[model samples]
Target: MVTRILSENEQDLRLAGEIIAAGGLVAFPTETVYGLGANALDPDAVRKIYEAKGRPSDNPTIVHIADESALKQLTWRVTPDMQRLARKYWPGPLTMVVPRRDTVPNVTTGNLDTVGVRMPDHVTARALIQAAGCPIAAPSANLSGKPSPTTVEHVIDDMDGRIDAIIRSTPCTIGIESTVIDMTGELPMILRPGFITREDVARTLGKDILVDPTLNEKPEPGVEFRPKAPGMKYKHYAPEADMIIFEGETEAVEAAMDEERAERESLGQKVVVIRYSQEDTETAAHEFFAALREADKDKADIILAAALPQEGIGFSVMNRMLKSAGYNVRKV
Candidate 1:
């Protein structure tokens, strides 16, 4: 895998931008995580994203920009609440699903009338987008079914000249995907969760954003629930190995992981266990999937993860990990 260390400079940004403009993939950073980017305006370029990630053609990519002006090119309708959220959260870890403009390719919007867009706060990504002169369609810089890469090394390991370049980011600030909300629906709906929460968007809108039931299932067609973004329809951010997690309330999950750990240890099989740790590290939700992904790499046969509290960042990360790992995912 070819890896390039990037400094915040015009030269590297220009190189990455040139690749995007010329219809190639580039991996760059955002506050949330690194993304594999291509020119959003070019369907051919956008198709390369699915090719690189081994992502299904039906699963769309999010359009990322440096500034709010680029949003004008992708979305036809941005509501007042959407504006408020964008003003406060853009250039950060949030993705808004708004009505797609004619310029937005159907592939980029997953054939949905709505499009997913974000203004990444990372200097490297912003500079590259500015130099490229168009919105960049980006998904997590990893294989389609694996965990999202949070570091430059992760991107290089999974996708190296399958892309144009890798911009060495200063480690991901959020260590997960962006919070995705769909304003195109009758009520705002959270398609995916991250650093931004449903409560956070609800507080901004002064009304609760509806949570979709489809989130609990595999990404399949003809499902009864409505979806606005690509992540909603597929499993994502998973590890290479099989991972099973305990669901529901925190204490029950803890006991489940504990019992699984004891049982496996007795069988002499090395196991990786994840439980909520308040003092040892970041919130439980954020670290659980990372642990599972890490465990999968070490050849651990089993991963026991516990569900976190509904409050704060815990809820968002847990939901993503569980979905990515797939359900019927043994209740640890």
Candidate 2:
């Protein structure tokens, strides 16, 4: 069994930092989500991230830093857009993909010349990074292919002995990973969408932020091109149960889900309906599924979600929904 401790003091923070300094893994909270962090510069320490999370070696981890100056340690060739975006969104939920330096291990960048980096706003995470004095390569603090843990409890559920220590915190405020934009490409493009939409990035850059159709998973026929991003490829952010996301008008979609729920009930299987944030202000896209977890706390049969509007940040929200649902879309 794993020993679970709630760390909320200076001494515990120091201890957690020490564990990271010594090249051990630490599951700590970030503004976006909890991340499994290890020394980004050390191959051995970085490899532990692989063994513990069972993450694919090809899947790159983001470098968590305390400040912009930390960027010098791992990368260079920063663009003016990178500077503006960094000044605006650093210390929050934004990841900038930039050209890598020789110091960044191949393990951290997935052998690519570019690396995704961010300065997190979470205090414990920043402290650990400051204490360790190096960018910590981290990904969501769960086994590679599961829903990213947004709470410390979820971290404990997925990682305990697998890491050296856990810096627990409340459920993530952002409740989603950063918007990962690749500047290395010809045009600035959003590789993954979070609270920061492509429009936001475009508006900031004074140029159109080109969006690849690959960002959204279309389950229709005549599909040939491949997505150039990571989050677009796999079944991610999924809980133990199965999930489906409904697409169309809200009322009509809800009606479809009610029927889907009835079908599951008739089949003697539990079902959950995930409506859009527009339906309930209290259940914003960020906390929609997390809120429903209690209703299905006993491990229900499946999760079916109604497609959320692309308006506002709901677009990014739906990306996580459909991805987690594993492209489970049904026509009513």
| TM-score winner | 2
Q: Could you tell me the lDDT of residue 69 within candidate 2?
A: 88
lDDT of 2 by residue, 195-298 (tens): 77887888888898876666666556565433334465555766778777778776788888888889999999977766655744324655854644443476
- Error (Å) of candidate 2 at residue 51 is 1.0
* Full-model lDDT, candidate 1: 0.76
lDDT score at residue 171, model 1, on the 0-100 scale: 72
User: Per the 3 Å backbone cut-off, how many clashing residue pairs does candidate 1 have?
Assistant: 1
lDDT of 1 at 9: 80
TM-score quality measure for candidate 2: 0.91
Could you give me the TM-score of model 1 versus the true structure?
0.89
**Looking at candidate 2, what is the lDDT of residue 31?**
78
C-alpha lDDT score of every prediction, in listed order: 0.76, 0.77
State the number of backbone clashes in model 2. 3
TM-scores for all candidates: the values are 0.89, 0.91
Candidate 1 positional error at 151, Å:
1.2
